[model samples]
Target: MSTNRRTFLTGLAAAGGFAIASPAVLGQAKPRVVVIGGGAGGATAARYIAKDSAGAISVALIEENEVYQTCFHSNLFIGGFKSYEEISHRYDALAKNHGITLARARATQIDRDKKEVVLSTGARLPYDRLVVSPGIDLKYDSVPGWSKDVEEAMPHGWKPGRQTQLIKQKLDAVPNGGTILMIAPPNPYRCPPGPYERASMFAHVLKASGKRDCKIFILDPKDSFSKQGVFQEGWEKHYGAMIEWLGPKVHDGIKSVDPKTNTVVTGFETYKDCAFVNVIPAQMAGEIARSAGLAPAGGYCTIDPASMKSVVDPNIFVLGDACIGGDMPKSAFSANSQAKVAAMVIRGELAGARTFPARYINTCWSLIETDDTVKVGGRYEAKDGKIAAAETFVSQPRESAELRKENQAENVGWYAAITADMFS
Candidate 1:
């Protein structure tokens, strides 16, 4: 084995040994794992543990929302191609079929010393192991002059459900030949390609509505974004003169917006009377993670790649957008991939078996236009206590009609499979 690989395996073995020994010293009962945030990662972990443990280990899930509206296909709703109901799912299947106790409550805090999760209702759920996938929480303050109360004026729509509908409503209410301003957040946010895809979908709506004069302006914090070249090409071909992008150097791309005045300030220039403003701000792990003392100073939870366990509190493991996994962008696909790895590690540790070196894979697909799509995929491996991309499977700038059609179809299929895997 390579030097780095050898070192990683050795460290994992040592950590596993320490975990096993510590239980004996601590005098804990049979292992019971509790998972928080029953979205992609938490749901997957709960189902896998419940099925794989064979009743030897207990598994429980906690979530605030009874229904989950996936963010993956939410852009379709914005584009008027699909309804919100199409992307929403319930937890009935998880509770009835999976044999996992679904606690419909928000986690208030995690007592690391006692290994217990405190709920918002003041109920405490004890666990031998805790898995958190609370996902991303919007940093509204990241953009000056914007607060939660001002959300009605400028919707971030980062989270799924009502916020998405509100943004779509705002778009639909805009006058014909109006301008839509989309502000993309900085790096290390949920779904790197989401903002661009959203802009494309909005443009599609504008074209279909016969608003030929309507334009979508993207104010981006980064110089370049995912599938930039392909998205630009699609915009030029499909919505010529209707789409414009300004990067950081372009006056830092709208430093602030005064909702009442209907003005967006970028350096010395001001854009007034924009119909809709979709401001995607910076993101961090959900408040639950921060309350649980799981997040690091940088506002994300640090975890050991081998087991996805929080370094400070070994009993707790965090995944999805909340985790700081090297080279893994926070996306539903990446969360699903990491969930499987986390499940295997939890299973092995609880079963007193050796934790195997594992690999994770993530593939993110973005629709530039109705028939044009772009994708990027990669594999990650644990190295020296952190995860690193081992390989990539990316789509080219331009694709054949057949390939584009295949991707579009596959995107739907993937969504179905993943959501089913989570709730069903």
Candidate 2:
């Protein structure tokens, strides 16, 4: 370790459990970084900044949850291909190994002018830089007659955690020959291919459970979806006639939902007697971001494509599903990529580290069946004041079986690597 790192470690050891020490007490200024949220983007950002800075910067991570269950690969858990425990990750390593102060409290407000974060416990944390990556919040009312109270009957399962378990329970309890109704969200939502991947998972569980007569209906607001050809081909090959996708032209629009009777009233027709329902409503940046006035008309935080700094507040950096990443779809991988760019910029500004041009990459992998996977991704860079796609690829229909298996294996490997990068 360098002399600067040794001095940093000594300061941390002297400060005890306190991640940030007063300038008067330390006899020098210690730049502090406060990060909110512990998901893909937030966790990765916190770890990289704290680790690469080598304790030169005081880092505090605020997250309400002790253990985080990833929204990524959650469909595999629901499909019985992976266990819930396998997808769940603990944050102890981040604190113990990376020297991040774990503030197990919700951040109630962001005082951007003051450069401080107010916690639910009424404590205030002052920071030189703040990273806000609280992810997406579902707009329950976006779909008429739907809210949190009625979510039990028609769980979105979009946020992971309890909703994920509930959806799996509902899926297992679904009777043979039952029909499942899924209302897919519009464009610019987290994980563009998530709902369709979930549909495939539901089909897998039903088929594996010998409920061959069970069927699913996907009502999408958009005319087309991510990897439409690949997903359609995979569904036809594996699910046969089990799944049906209806676009806006067919469903007209979702008028209302009666969760009590498991009914969905669309502009075209009324769907009643649905055995299970998953309604992924429109989304916005999390409450903290909205309350801070960081988001604009699009309901997402807009940032400088080169640095990931919020347009509204230079001291605040936004990441993941909450930020409007130009050509990059809102996915965990995209968020992780953005986090690194933001971290590099912050370090360059605060720690005098060398800065480089921002380059980003993202790949979204969706499993359609056992050993059948499809993907869409691209390389991105800061160009013309926006994150522009440089190169892109997508899985095509009628690929070789070996190639499909390889894609599935690659997905599994990525999950392992990314979770380690975030929490371990």
Candidate 3:
């Protein structure tokens, strides 16, 4: 850690009075802030609060994993373009250097009336303000014949880590010129262009393996998808017949899957003998959010747009994929932007300043091929009691090779800087 960062953290601890003279003396009163789910949104919020609060807020971060592997570039790993280690990060820096109390445990429930969070281990954390950003959990039971037991046979690989590796291994072990099946969920899922990008990556691997006959079949519930025009053009120009996309109206898509037989059944037909399958089921807010009574009927948290505070409980703020941001796609970039705004709002509230309306920025990039990338960016403003897109900063199709390369490099730089800002 840098000397400047250490000095900043020390000053924050002194201001917040979080540093204890001894372990026994640590049980005194303090303005506690508990953050659930240490992913992009939660981690960024925690880092900012710990760094900028100047000891006025004591932040505790709860996450199940000690190390986090990003979902953003996991498709590249599946496509054989990158390794798992390339996208994984540890939280030691945040704990040891940033003065954050990192708890590696799942949050069990929230007692809103008591202003406390209960962990699975039975420890209760009292907080003046709480933040939830657990991301999404797959709704496996939504799709008939697909259950948690079938995960070993056909992985979703949506949340990153071992499931991702399992799918990649299956793809690698498949026979040359074999077929890979990808089941894409409906709208309002994480990463709008993710499934298509996964398909493109798989096609790249097949092309490199001398398996020109190999095919990637995308069974999508929606008739249209993000970056559709750019993806279609890239597919035709690069992979051509190697990639097949079946929309809901045409193929009826996949209603269910039989893991025992390795068969995917659509309303119109059934596919058999699939070498590998990635069934990305529908999603909802993480379990902790739902348990806390923060989630609404749509399985996402409802928050006031101005303060990012829970509608059911004012002391709690929800952001990122767990919260319903009007008309915003759930992406890491979007999460980071929301975190910054939420942090600012929370800080102002803590400092006893009047809260202002929130503004957000979103930029999503999808890598169609090794050298081909597509991007979309926009700014959002809260208007008429709902957040809406105010301006499109950059939403265009990829045309030139130079632009694609530049976008790819920019995407990498963004991943590095954002992650560093959060954990480092």
Candidate 4:
């Protein structure tokens, strides 16, 4: 094996040894693994552990909602490429097919010392191992002049479900020649490509709705964004003069927002009387993780890149957007990939299953316009104690129509496969 690969495997073996040596409670009939959150990370981890264990371990999945509408494809729903039902998933199959227990309650707290999850329904669910995949919680007050009370007027739509539909409704209500201003979040946010995709989707809706005069403005705090070239090309070709992106250099910085007046003041200029505003503020790990003292400094849990086990507590694993994933972008595919690693390590530690070296894969696809999509992804390995990128690929700008269409197909196929992986 290569030097990096050898080092990576050695780290995995050492982490596995540490997990195996973790103190276990006595007098248990079956080792119980409790997973928090039912999104891509927690759902995939729960399914894998339950299925691969083959009745050797019990898996309990704790989630607030029974039906999950994926944030990954919700942009397509906003663009009218997919329906709400297409992005929605239920956990019934996970219970029936995989023999996993679905606990339909919000996780209020994580008792690290007691090894239990406190639910909103005043129940304590004990576990030998805890998998926390509660995705990001929006910092509503992070953006100036924005807060939870004004969210209805200026929707974030970062979390899937009601916000997604609300944003779609707000977009539909925009009059012809109206303006929509979207405040993109800063760095280290979930789905690095998301804000740009949402802008594309918004443009798609306005263009297809015969509102050619409608304009969408993305005020980004970052200098550049994911698939910038491909998205720019597609926007220019399809929505010509309909979209604008103001980087920090151009916008200076967001000064303030007035929800009642539908106005936003930036350091350089002020946008007045906007028809709609998407204020996606800064984000951090879900509230449960923060409340549990799992997130120390970065507002995210630090985990061993080799095993996805928390550096704070070896028995608790963090997945998805809640953990620092080294080089991995906080996307559903990355979460699902990390979930498998956590499941493998958990099985190895608790069920005496053989373990292998950790290898992670992620592909993020963004639909630029109808039948036009771009992708970026890579294979990753634990190197130098971080999940470092090994091999990477991305769609190029000015690709042929056929190639873009094929990429779009791949995007659709991946959504189906991943949602099935998580919920089915």
Candidate 5:
């Protein structure tokens, strides 16, 4: 290893974030860890803790759903690149291979004072340490005239699963020369690049079906979005005049929506009888996380960058979209990377295992068109009590076809690798 790597390892060895809880030394039973919301972060943390501890720690993964549907690649499914089953994963591998106990029940409450998790079934689970990775939840009133009840008519496929399927069906039902509208979410939401990719998917499907006349309009609330240069360039090159993006400055923000008539009233223009509409409203941390007192008024938990432990309660770790990950965007790759650091720290403390310094990395890949993909990524480390970017890179505009194709292949491979890291 290099000198800097050695220094990091030395620091990890010298640090005692949590007291060693070795059962032999303390004359106690194996330490039990409970993880909530088994998606990207929770699943990986539970599996790593169980596998690394080698029965020194008992792990329970409490998730309401037996199968996890990923929000990351649901856009590809909409574009007909993947199927619903392809993006779905099960917890069978974590249980059979890593000895993780899977509980298919929702966690209703987090009793931090008692160090217990109350489940929806009225059972309480005790944890020596708790890991929570509940993902984003929609703020229905964030959009004018939009609420949870009208989601079936105007679907926001942000959470994945049935909503994702609903959006795909709406896209498929649009006729040639039909109008499709998407109200993109505001800042600091889950997946900075997701809304743009979904728009690309919409154009891709319509263009493929020779529905080039079908109009796709994006009413964006933000001034600029992730990878705006490349995404806009790709849209002009592949699906010219088929997609139109109007920022807040141009549209003067959304005035109201008539869900019954599939209409949107904007300051500049009123779009009526839109064949398809996707209204992704503002979002916050999931309800369970807020209820646990892990979040403040910001609706996200501040975590210690070195350990992914919640700043509010040292005994609890918050991961994924629920935590305020300074530089790391809310993505599966970021969550999975953070989980490794958390698992190592938990193992080092409770099982007396070796520890390593935390290094977080993330790359968000967006597929623009056939064999055309772009990505933005960075390496982050804890510095001055917060995560900061050490190195970063993004794909430039008008790249070579061969290089873009390679990037697309990389995106596909990463999806496979990350899902395996989380579930298997």
Candidate 6:
């Protein structure tokens, strides 16, 4: 973020007088704010509430994992540009410095009637306001003949952590001239450019390792993807004929996938044998969100655009990949941006703190090759009862190498800055 943007957000945080509807949460003795998932959205919301309220609000963050492996730049790590520890963030700082309670246990249920979150250990946490940001969950049955049990053989690496490491290890173990297949997810998934960037990283590894004979196949369910022209241009320029993308017109549909034999079956062709297969199935909001009836039939929670409050319940807010982020792609930066708005709004409702109109910004920078990156971003605001795009930009093809290098620098810088914004 630039100094101008930082100053603008700080000003918004400091000075505002608007008030929204609230439950009977006002004038409580240190009203509790409970945040779940502790990723970009949860952590930022928790920190901002504790900091801005100056201990007037008690914040509790519930995350099952002590260390969070960010999914934002895991592709870069797989491509050898980053170390594992570099993307991992710890919650010790959040607890010690922010005076927030950290709960390290799986949240099993959201008892809206009782106004409590039931943990896996059978403990209940009462809250005046709840922020559910559990991120995404893969629909195991979305892919034919694939299930959670098959993840060991065919890993998605979508949510990061061990799956990320497993995919990296598998990539390293592939023999020279071997073929790798990736089953791309459908639209409305997290990280719009992730799969293609990962494919570029795979090619980068092969080209660097003198394994140019290896081939990569991306069977995408969509006709086109984000930054299609630029990605295709870069692949043709750098990877030569090493990568091939088969769209729905060509693949027709996925018949089945046999993880036991490392095979993928498509309508046009059946890959009877493959060295490695990475399948990213369809996704939905996390288990707790769907189970709590907050998410509608579409498998994502609906939220008021201005405050990010759940449409069904004013006291509950949903953030990150779990909420229907109209006109916004589900990126870590977007989640972090939404978190701040939710924090400000929650404070306005609970502590009678000042509030301002919500504005969100997101920029997704994708690394294609060495010092070669591309990006797509925008600024958004609430309009017509929905969060709509106000301004947008994307990388263009035939750009100078120097400009691409500059974009890569931006990618690195933004990653460092946003990690601190979320976890520090």
Candidate 3 residue runs with Cα over 4 Å from true position:
1-29, 353-357, 393-398
User: What lDDT tens digits, residue by residue, belong to model 5 across residues 350-378?
Assistant: 77677777889999999888889999999
Candidate 4 yields a Cα-based lDDT of 0.91
TM-score of each: 0.94, 0.93, 0.90, 0.96, 0.96, 0.95
> Model 1, 136-234: lDDT tens per residue?
998888887777888878988889988999889998887788989888899889998899889989988888888889988888889999878878888
User: Which parts of model 6 have CA positions greater than 4 angstroms off?
Assistant: 1-24
Better of 3 and 6 by TM-score: 6
Lowest-sum lDDT 10-residue window in model 6: 14-23
With a 3 Å backbone cut-off (N, CA, C), the pairs that clash in candidate 2 are: none
lDDT of 4 by residue, 1-424 (tens): 8976776577567656755566463235789999999999999999999999998889999998978999998999999988999998899998899899888899998888899999999999999999999999998878889999999999999999999999999999999999999999997899999999999999999988899999899999999998898888888999998999999999999999999999999999999999999999999999998888888886888988988988888889999999999999999999999999999988888877767788899999999888898999999987798899999998998789999899899998999899889877
Which is the leading candidate under lDDT?
Answer: 4
Estimate the overall C-alpha local distance difference test score of candidate 5.
0.90
Global fold similarity of model 4 (TM-score): 0.96
Q: CA lDDT of each candidate?
A: 0.84, 0.90, 0.80, 0.91, 0.90, 0.90
Candidate 4 stretches with Cα past 4 Å from truth are 1-28
Cα deviation of 410, candidate 4, in Å: 0.7
Residue 78 of model 5: what lDDT? Answer: 95
Q: Candidate 6's residue-wise lDDT over 1-424, tens digit each?
A: 9855764575455444233334445646789999998989999999999999999999999999989999989999999999999989999987888899999999999999989999998999999889999999999999998999999799999998999998899898778889899999997899999999999999999899999889999999999999989999999999999999999999998999998888999999988668789999988999999898888767788999888999988779999899999999999999999999999988887888877678899999999899999999999988788889999999999999999999999999998888887777
